[model samples]
Target: MGIVELKNLTKSYKQNRGIMDVSFSIEEAEIFGFIGPNGAGKSTTIRTLLNFIYPTSGSATIFGKDIIQHSKEIRQNVGYLPSEVHYYDDMKVVDLLKYSARFHGNLNSTRMKDLAARLDLDINRKIEDLSFGNRKKVGIVQALLHEPKLIILDEPTSGLDPLIQNHFFELLAEERDKGATIFFSSHILSEVQKMCDRVAIIKEGKLVAVETIEHLTKNKVKNITITFEQPEQFTFTVDGILKREVNGKEVTLLYSGEIKALLQHLIDLPVQDVLIEEPTLEEIFMHYYE
Candidate 1:
C-alpha cells in the first residue's frame, strides 16, 4: 500500500466550489509535488490530508491508517510546515522548539542544535523579535526536530532567502535519503522541477494531471531555434506546435511531436543553423494551463 492515499476526496465550501474528486498517492520515501496557481485547492487538499478539515466526501489514509479516524496516531509520525507560521510571542525560539519536540514525545538535543546552527537561527532570540526568514527557520527546525517519517511542507520556502532556501532543500534531501516520505506543495514550477520526483497538477479545484517528472517532460515540448540563409516568409504547417517567434533571418518555435517529421520538413528549408532543446517547466506549465 502507498504511504499516502486519497480516493475521490472532495471538499466543498460554497456555490459548488472547492476541490472535487481529488485523488493521488505518495509512495514511501517519495517526494511528491503538489502544484497549482493561487486558489487552485492545493491548500484545501493538504488540509484534508492532515485532518485540519474533514472532506465532504471520499477518504484518505497515511501509513495505511485512515487520516481522519487515526489522526492523532498519524500525526505522531507526521511533521508539517505551513505557508505561514505563528508562534507564542513571549517564548524564546529554543523553548518553543523544545515544546514542539516534547509534544511529539521525542526530543533530540543534538539534532535541534545542529538544525539551528545550519539554519543560522539564533535560538536564544524571542519569537517576537526574529525576522520573517528567521521565524521560518525556526518553523523548519521545529518540524524536523523529531525526525518524523512523513514531512508535509506547504510553500515551505516563502520567507527564505535564496541561500537559506538552498540550505533548507539540502536538509530535506538528507531527510528523504534517510527513508522519509515528503509531500511538497508549491506554485514555483522551477522548484518543483528541481525537487520532486513526480508532480500532481490541479486547476480550478480539480486535478489536471499527475505523472513522473521524466514522463511529464519527455518529448512533450521541443524548443527549436533556426537561422536561415536569408530572410524568408517563415511559415510551416505541423502538428503540436504551440508557439512561434520570428526575427531577422531567424526563427524560434516550440514543438511537441514527431521530431522525425519536423526534421524531414526542415531538410528542404533554408535552415543554415539549428538548435534543439527541451522546454523549461514554465513553458510546459503554460501548455497545460492552455
Candidate 2:
C-alpha cells in the first residue's frame, strides 16, 4: 500500500472551483512532485491532506488511517513547510526550533547543530532581524528537525539561494534514504525535474497527468529544425506531425512518434544541419490544455 492516498477527492467553494475528482498516491521513500500553475488548487489539496480544512467530498488517507479522523496522529508523523511561513517576530531561531521540537519530543543537540551549520542558519538571530531567505532557512530546519516519516514541502525553495537550495535537497535525499516519503509541490519545473521520481500535474482545478519524469519527457512531442542545402518546398506527410513550417531553406517540424521514419525521411533529403529539441514540462502541459 502507498504511504499517502487521495481517492476521488473533490473540494469546492461557493462560485469558485477547487480540485475536481483528484486522486493520486505516493509511495514510501519516494520523492513525488506535485506541479501546477498558480491558484490551480495545489494549496487547497495540500490543506485538505494536512486536515487544515475538510474536503467537501471524497477521502484522504495516510498509512491506512483516514486523515480527518486521525489528524493529530498523522500530523505527528508529518512535517510541512508552507510556501509562506509566518512566525513570531521576537523569537530567536533557537527558541523557535526548541518550541517546535517539543511537539515531537526533544531533538538531539548534535543533529540540530549539524543541520544549522549545513544550512548556514544562525541560531541566535531574532526572527525579525533575519532576511527573507534566512527566515525560510529557519522554517526548513523546523520541518526536518522532527524527523517525520512524511515531509510535505510547498515551494520550499522559493526564497533560498542556489547553494542553500542544493544543500536543502541533499537533506531531503538523506531523509528519503532513511525511509521518509516526500511530497514536494512547486511551479518550478527544473527543481521538480531534478529531484522527483514522478510528477503529478494539475491545471485549472483538474488533474491532468501523472507519470514518471522519464515517461513524461519521452512521450512529449519533439521539435526538429532542419536546414537543407537548398530551398525546397515540401510538406510533412507523417501521421503524428502536428506542425510544419518552411522558412527559406529551414524546415521546422513538430511531431510525436517513433523517430525511425522521420530519420529515414531526413536521410533522403539534402539536409545541411539538423537540431532536435525536447518539449519543456510547460510545453507538454500547454498541448494538453489547448
Candidate 3:
C-alpha cells in the first residue's frame, strides 16, 4: 500500500455534486499534485481523506490505517493547510501557533521562531491586525510547526507573493527531503509544474487523469512556433497537431506525436526561428476536457 491510498472513494452531495469513484495512491516522500478549479470537489476529496467529512462510500487509508477509524491518530502525524484560513481574532499569532502545537506535544518555541523568521512573519502581531497574506504565513508556520509525516496543502500559495511562494516551495522541498509525503492541491498549473513529480487532474468532482509531469506535458502535447524573416504563410498537415494559428510571418500550433517527424516536416520550410514548449496545465486540461 502507498503512503496515502483511496479506493473507489465517493462523496455525494445534494444536486449530484461531489466526487465519485475516485481512486489514487500517493507514494511515500513524494509530492503528489491535485489540480482542478474551485467547486471541482478538490476540497471535498481532501476533507474526506482527513475525516473532516465522511465519505459517502469507499475507503481511504493513511499510513496503513483507515482514515475514519484512525482519524485522530492519523491527524497526529499529518499537517494540513486549507484553502481558506480562519483564526481567532483575539489571539496573537504566536499564541495561536503555540496552542496548535500543543496538540502534537510540539510547543517548541525555537522551531516556531525559525519558521516565522524564514517566512518573514511577525508572530507577535494580533491575528486581526495581520493582512490576508500575513495570515496565510501564520497558517504556514502552524502547519509545519510539528514537522508532520504528511503535509496536505490546498491552494497554499493563494495570498503569498512570488518571493514568499518560492520560499514556501523550498520549505516543502526540505520537508520532502526529510521523508514527508506531500499532497499539494492547487488550481494553478505553474506551481504544480514546478513542484510535483506527478499530477492528478480533476474536473467537476471527477478525476480525469493521473500522470507524471513529463508524461502529461512532454509526451502529451507541445507548443511549437515557427517564425520567418518576412511575411510568409505556412500550412502544417500533421495528424497530432491539435491546434494551429497563423499570424503574418509566424505559425504557432499545439502538436503531439514524434518530435523527429515534426522537425523533419519543418526542415524544408524557410524557418528563421523555432520555439517549442510544453503546453501548460490549462492547455492540458482543455485537451482532456475536449
Best by TM-score: 1
Candidate 2 residues lying further than 4 Å off, grouped into runs, are: 231-234, 242-248, 264-270
Predicted candidate 3 versus true structure: per-residue lDDT over 90-208, tens digit per residue: 99998999899989986889989999998999989999999999999998899899999999998999999999999999999999999999998998988999899999998888899
The TM-score obtained by model 1 is 0.95
TM-score between model 3 and native = 0.90
The C-alpha RMSD in Å for every predicted model, in order, reads 1.6, 2.1, 2.4
Model 1, 1-290: lDDT tens digits are: 89999999999997745899998999999999999988898888989999999899999999999999999999999999988899999999989998988889878999999999998999999999998899899989988999999999988998899998999989999999999999989999988999999999999889999988887777578888989999877887788778888899988888887888888888999889999988888788877888
TM-score of each: 0.95, 0.92, 0.90
What ranges in model 1 sit over 4 Å off?
15-17
* Model 2 lDDT, full chain set: 0.88
Number of the candidate with higher lDDT, 1 or 3: 3
What pairs collide in candidate 2?
none
